[model samples]
Structures are given as structure tokens and as C-alpha cells.
Target: MNPWALSGVVLVAAVTFYLGKRSSRYANTTHDFLVARRTVRSRRNAAAISGEYLSAASFLGVAGVVLKEGADALWYPIGFTAGYLALMLFVAAPLRRSGAYTLPDFMEARLASEPLRKLCTVAVVAIGVLYMLPQLQGAGLALEAVMPAPAWLGAVGVTVLVTVNVMAGGMRAITVVQAFQYWLKLFALAAPTFVLCVVFFGTGGAGSAGSLGDPAPPVFREDTTVTVETGASFEVSEETPVWLPAEEGGQRVWLPGVRYEVDEGTTLRFPEGAPVPAVSGGEMDNASWLRPAEDAGALLGTYSLIFATFLGTMGLPHVLVRFYTNPDGKAARRTTVQVLVLLGLFYMFPVLIGALSRMYVPELLVTGRTDAAVLLVPSAMLPGVPGQILGAVTAAGAFAAFLSTSSGLLVSVAGVVATDVLAGKVRDFRIATVTMAALPAALAVSLPVEDLSLSVGLSFALAASTFCPLLVLGIWWRRLTWPGAMVGMCVGGGLVLLALVLNVLSEYSGGWAPWFIEQPALLTVTAAFLATIVVSLGTARRIPDDVNAVMLRLHAPDPLGFMRDRAEARFGRIEDRSRKRGKHRK
Candidate 1:
């Protein structure tokens, strides 16, 4: 057990507790809990949004994917940051101008349909839960790397801490905590990265790794010994010499390059600059790893991934809720601009870490545990105390990613449950938080873990299919009717939901799941747009009576006082400006 890593994680938890406790007093109303009373300024709101946006996927999964898939994995971070562009261009200011606390609130207010609102409420919770699974998976990986504990303990720890924080002060407390976490995360990743780059490059270690364009697979930077903890099978492209463990007679042998299956507890030692073995006998090849595959299915999946991320940002419930905390439409827009800059800055560091890990931690590739690339890189590159300290910093950053994103998502889910299912009061919100968090927490512990980035992609594809079309058309198109919007959402959302269910079944049943089922974003998003347009045109006469008024409000400046209807009929006490305030003689 590394004391440095454990202490770093504990320190981060202590800080989170302190911040959440300090902000607990001000969350006195639903508005404060749901939207921070719409009083957060642009700069701080941007930091919180970026903080929550950079989840487990960004911190750990991206690096892992890069280590496994090479250049193709670069698309994940690119898509993640680019998604914000869609929000800024189409959704941000208009959604904030609508003055709604949640997605369901907007649906009911925009179309004047309670049924549509309820439909969206279900969708929000589904997306929130799906998104949370990956965060917990990442949390587990981080803790398990540094300490001798079961992976489920890390999952439960994150779930419990986030639930307590969200239940304590809701969005008001989360805002401050998330913003602070963003800076800490930035420092944690940045400081170690600076040192790693300087030491590795300045000390002439760079020349041994070779270029990305090198035809041969990556080589071990130095003589290294590795043992398979579970089991792994990998292929070699060239004859390689490996020294077996002492129990296996401790002899070195030249094995022909072929698919070799290894049992658990197998250990091997490779000499310095030896070519790394290829896993799955495909992308691990140096040139193949650097370029896109030529297969049609692979091409289609890539497009789906790009669309899922590019269009999915505006649709994410947790991300969308941050905009509502902005005081006005302009602030929301400004905050998005700032978020774009912050996110772009943070993504490059993880990419560098992944690239470096390829040379230093080549054994992870053979073992199919590339997700540990980021956590292991610092130690693999630098040995002993210095490496442990840097690894601890990274583990802390990973925790930040888990807690911030999980808290934001839990709050969003709880708010939906409180407003849609319960009495929509502060008390209901508190109860809903605990209730909403419980199911995901249990599932995170019991369910088998998945690749964090891929799991997050499932949520993005679902969001893109369902909410992206609704927000874009709802704000811009005056001819949109409630029936049309409902049908479109059902068609698009239903496909993705079905895909998710089938994907889950395939895991247990050993059935073949197609690429489209795993990544339906491109197809579903197009179907949603087409369905919404066709259905609306057919039902043009059924448009809302106040369509023009709503459109004007969505587009007009906030100071004009025509920005929105708050839909208080369902979610009462969201804001009560006429209520008396406590006064004192000054």
C-alpha cells in the first residue's frame, strides 16, 4: 500500500466534506437546490461546468483508450470538447432564457403538455443513471490501483460521498465544490505532467521510444518483468526472446511470432528495446494503431461515435443544468465560451500521458488493462517516492473527476424525481436524492465493470438521439406541436433505449450485438430530426396557441421580460419573489 496515494485520496475527501458542509446553509429553497437560484456568475459557473464535464471518461478512460487503440482514441477527447460547441451555438442561451429548472420543466412549459414533461422526466433519470455507472467504474479503478482493497469498495465510497454531498446542500453546495475541484484537478494533472515531460525528454529517454510513424510495434524502454494477474492471450509479429519464471526452470527461449495463450500466474521478462507483443493481433500494430481502419462497419462506428459526442453535449442533463445557474441568457452564453477554453486546455494533458505510457508501461497493453495507463504512467516513468507522489496526485485528480460529475448527475436526477414524482419541495428533493442514488450505487457494486470511456459513450449516444433534436427544434421552430415532439422523441429515444437493453443482454447471453446497436447515435439522431420535421408539418394546425410568444421569448434578450413562463403549476416554490424576506435594522 502506498501511503502517498492513500493520503492524497483522503485529503481530497476531507476537502470535499469541508466545502459541502460550508455551503449547506444556503440551499433553503428548490431554486437554490436545483439551479443555485440562478445567481452564479459566468466565470465561476464556467469552472463548475468544466469541472463536471471532465468526468471519469476524460481523466482516466481517454488515456486508457489511447493506450489501447492508439490514435483512434484521440477522437474521444476531441468529441467531448467539441460537444460544447453545439450547446453554445444552439442550446445554451435559449434554454437558459426559458427559465426552467430541468428538462421536463422546459418540455411542459414550451409545449404546454404535462405528458411530454413526464416523458422527459423518465429520460433524464435514465441518462443520469447510465452516466453515473462509468464514474463509479473509474473511481474503482483509481483506488484499486493504489491500495489493497476490493474494487467495489472504491465504487461504494464514491457513491456514498457524492450522495451525502448532494443531499446535504444540493446544487448550491455542489457549485462551489465543483468549481474548486476543477482547479485542483487542473493542478494535479498539470504539475506532474510538467515534471514527467521535463525528466523524460531532458534526460534523453525520448529517443528510445521511437516515432509514432515507426513501422515496428512499440518497444520496452528498458528491461522489464511482467506477470499476468488474471490471464491474457497475445500474438507476436516477430520471434522474441522471453525469460520464464523460476518455477518454470528460469530459462530464456526464442518463441516464434504467433498467437500464444497464457495461463494465469504466468510471468515473463523481456530485454530492453524488445518489440511489444500485439494484443488481439490487430490495432496493436504500430501503423494500424496510428490510422483509421478501412472496414465499412469500423467507419460507420467512428461516425456514430463522433455524432454521439458532438451532438450529445447539449443534451446531457447535468451539463444543461449548469447553464440554468447563469443569471441570464447572455451569461449562459458567456459561460459556455469560457468552458470551451477550459476543456480544450485540460484534454491535451491526458493525451500526452497516454502516448508516453505506450513506451513506459507496455506490459499493460499485453494484459488488456490499458485503463490503468494514466494511473500507472507516473510511477512507471519515475520510480520510488517521486513516482508514488505523482501517482497520488493523479489518483486525487481521478477522484475529483468521479465525485464532481457524480454529484452533478445525482442532483439532476433527484431534482427530476422530486419535481415530477413527489411534491417538488426541498424535503422531497432531499428524499429523492437518497432514493435516486441507491439503485445506481447498488448496480455499480454488483454489475461487472466496463471500459469507462465506452460506458460513457452509451449515455452520450442515448442523449443525442433523444434530447438533441428536441432542444434544437423546440427553440427554433414555431410550427412544433406537442404531439409531433412526443412522437419524434419516442421514435428516436426508443431505438437507443432498445439498443442499450440489447447490449446488456448480449453480455450475459453471449449473443452477437451489432455495431449499430452499440452505437446508434448517427442513425438515431437523423431519424429523430426527420420524424420531428415530418410529424410537425403534418400537424401544423395543432401548434401551441402561444407558439409565437414562446418563440419570441426564447430568442429575445432577457431584459425585455419576455424570456419565459416558469411552469409553476407542477414545480411550485421554484422561486417566490413576492414572499417576504427576513429583515434587520442596519
Candidate 2:
């Protein structure tokens, strides 16, 4: 419960709030709120995109994984950064050219059906809500860990802060906030890591540092009353009893026959008390077929995670909504590539910190707070003022990560709920936005804190299931009909929701009732895609001729007026344009 630490976090948040308020005044209309009037340049927008994409999970969780799991954990960040690669190649230009404020808008224009729009809207809101929960939960967990505050309080506070930022200022405000937060987050981590390394090396523990201690030794307990007669020295805990021989350490530090109660299931470790016994050994030639399977199995797991991330990036609603905010298709494409570069740069630092945590702060594994492993590493490496300053900076970075990401998810969910369900009815949009943001905050309060990465993965599963197919097929395929889109959305959306529910139930009930499916992305995404294609084929004759025209606009490069012109060409005659022009003059 450090007041200074908590105050630092709150001060940083206050500054972010001020920046958001100042930036939001630019949003005056629905277009401004939804897409920043489609005027954001590619470079700044690219940084903003990277800022939103790298959530608290990526910042904090990845390092923890690397610390615990060795090189295998590096795959998470690789998959995350590589996701933008897939987007740049396939989804960027067409999605921006679709001339829609949101995915549901794209659906209405693409299929020319109010029914399909409604279905897509349903899926959008559902997935948005699911995705928001983890952001809220991450915020709570971060605040709880760094400060003495209760987790629920942090969750509620962040919900209010982000909701205000979005509702008051809209996309313009969020853009500025995210862009600024990205740099803040980067330096926050980078500064501490460098300082920690310098301090560690300067402490004269360079090469032959083994003399400092034998890596904390494993503790083993034989029975309850095992007494230690340390001829030299020893340390015993409730969990284990060990005796040190006269030659172990250099002095006798333990008394004999001191009976004590041993607490089972607890952990204890010995320091540099036991002397090493040198031995020469030959290569052990024991090999088994199981070894190959174990290695292959690990590789399969890594590939599965990477695959889910790459394809799943294309389907994320928040990410897709950002594309809709671009002024033109080319700008969107440029933004995508820039985002790749920005993310690639950001990924390098986290991997370095993760590796450092593995070597230096191995104790974090005992407490299962590997998520905070990076944040605490600097303090462990540098013990005084420099360490404290580095810790504060890292905390600020983590706070920035949570705030920027939560704001993005809040805007995405609230925008969808407002536009689709309420249709910009002021009162209803306000209510929907408030409720959408508030529900997750409340739910986050109830969660018994879990690893941030696991929760983020669930959010990805929801996004992949509901919106991935809708965006992919709607953009690339013209034959996709309204009924087909609706059916596909329902099947895909339904499977994802069902999978999530089954997962929760299985977690609570603990059995093989649902067949124990872990990764839902592959199956759910395929089902959605298949459903769209099948239904569209069955209803192919009902396809509208305007589909070809709209598809061209989405796929081809044109000026910013491309959408307005295509809209006019599809629905307006010469007389209609003249009438519109006349009205504009008046």
C-alpha cells in the first residue's frame, strides 16, 4: 500500500484525462465521433493503431511468460506483431474503401439489406462486449498489484474515465490519447530495463557471480519431527528440515534436536549453504520415442497460437473500426504497413525485458505473479533511488497500456451498440454506451483475478468467431447475399458464444461434458466462413447488380470522393445529382 506509488499512477491517469478532454472537442458530428472525419494521417494513425493493439496483456503478460516458459513464450509477441502483416496484405484497403462507419454499416452497404445489417449489428455488439471485459479486468488487476487499492475500485474508476474520454471527445480525442500513450509506454519500459542492467553490472557481480550464492536450492521434507544437527550452519522452515555438515558453509548456525511443526504443501529454499561436490560425467545415451512426440507437441501448440493470432487479427472489431476511420483506401493501406513497422519496434523491448526477468527475477514464479515479473525486475536489479524511479516509470507504462486499450475497446463496443441498436438516438446511444461500458466494469469486479494473457485470449476467441468471417467475406466476395450473411453470422456468432459458455461451465463443473475444447478460433472461424459461402450459393440468383459496383469501390483505389460518387452512381440519376447540387447552392 505505497502511497507514493499509487499517487504516481493516478497523476499519470489525470494527465491522460486532460489530454483526452482537450482532443475530443474536434468531434462534433457522427462522422467525427465514429471515424475522426476520415482525416488522420497514416503515420500518427499507425502509432495509434500500434498503441491500441498492444494491450496490457501484451506488455505485461508476454514478459511473464518468457520468464517462466523459456523461449517458447516469445511466440506470443511474434504472433501478435505478425498479425498486422496479414492485415496489410489482405484486409486493409478493401475494408477502408467499403465506405462504412462500422462493420454493420459495411454489411448494409455490401448486401443492401436491412435484415443483414441488424444481424451484423447483433454480432458486433456481442463481440465488442466480450472483448471489453478483459480490458476492464486487466485495469483492475494492474491497479491492485501496483497500489494498495481494491481491484473493483480500480475497475470502476477506469470504466468511468474511459467512458468519459470516448463520450465527450470521440475518435479524435482517443487518437491523440493513444498516440501519446504509445511513446509513454515504450519509454517507461525501456528506461527501467537499461538502468537495471547498468546497476546490476556496476555492483561487481559480473562473470564469476556464482560465489554470491548457490542458486536457491530445492527444499524437501521427510517427516514432521525431522531435527537438524547442523555441525556448521542450516536454515529450516515449516515446510522442510535440512542439516548442514561442518564443511557446508564455514560456521555452525543451527542447534540440534529442536522439534518443530512442519507445514505441508508450503515451499522453502536453501541459499549458498551446501557446498558443491565436483564429478566427471560421460554422455548419457538414454533416448526415447516419447521425446520426439513431446518436442512435436510443443511445436504444434506454438503454431496453433501463432495461427490464431495471425488470422484472428483480421477479425478484431476494434482494429477493423479503426480502418473505417481512414479518409481513403490508400491511406488505410499505408496505415496498416506503418502499423507493422511501429509494432515491430515495440515488440523488441518487451522480449528483452521478458528474457531479463527469466534470469534475474526467478522468484516471481513462486508467487505466480509472473505478469508483474517485468514491472518488479528493475527494483530487484537496482535496490535504491534509481530502482524506485524505474519502478514508477514502468508502472506508468503499464497504466498507459491499460488506459489506451480500454478506451479503444470501450469506443468500439459503445459505438456499435449506439449506432446499431439505438441508431444515434441521443438518449438511447447514451444509455447503451453507459451500460455497455459499465457492465464489463461490474463483471470485472467479480472475477477472481487471473492471468491477463488468458483473459485476452478469450477476447480474441470472441472476436474471431463473430466478426472475422463477416468482414472477410463481405469485403472479398460479392456473391454473399443477405440471408447468407445473416446465417453465417448466426452460426459463427452462436458457436463462439456457446463455446465461451461451455468453457465457463466446464471451469466450474470440471468434467468432459463439452468435450473440453480449448482453442475455438479454428473451428468457429471455419464454420462461419463455410456458412456464409453455402447460404450465399443457395441464394445466388437474388444477388443485386449493385454488388459489383460497390465491390469495385472497396477493392480499387480512388480519391476520397470514391464512396460518395459510387453511392451517387448506384442510386442517383442525372436529375437527382442536379437537384442535390441546387440544394447545396441554396
lDDT of 1 by residue, 1-586 (tens): 8789999999999899889878776567677788877778999999999899899998988988887788778889999999998899999999998888899889887898888898899899999999998888788888999999998888889988988889888998899889999998898888888989988878767644556668778887778788765455667666666777777767654444555666677877888777777664346557878887578887788889999999999889999988888888999999999999999999989998887777678778766667788888888778899999999999998899999999999999999899889988889999999998888888888876667899999899889988999999999888888888888889988988888899889745543677788788989999998999899999888788988887888899888988653845654544462153221111
- Consecutive 10-residue window with the lowest summed lDDT within model 2: 277-286
Q: What is the C-alpha lDDT of each candidate?
A: 0.84, 0.66
User: Would you estimate the TM-scores of all the predictions?
Assistant: 0.91, 0.80
For model 2, the superposed segments whose C-alpha errors exceed 4 Å read 2-4, 200-298, 425-428, 501-516, 565-586
TM-score of 1: 0.91
lDDT of 2 by residue, 463-563 (tens): 66666677777777778788887887788667766876786676555333332245566677678889889999999986877987887777766654565
The per-residue C-alpha lDDT of model 1 at residue 113 equals: 89
Residue 71, model 2, lDDT: 57
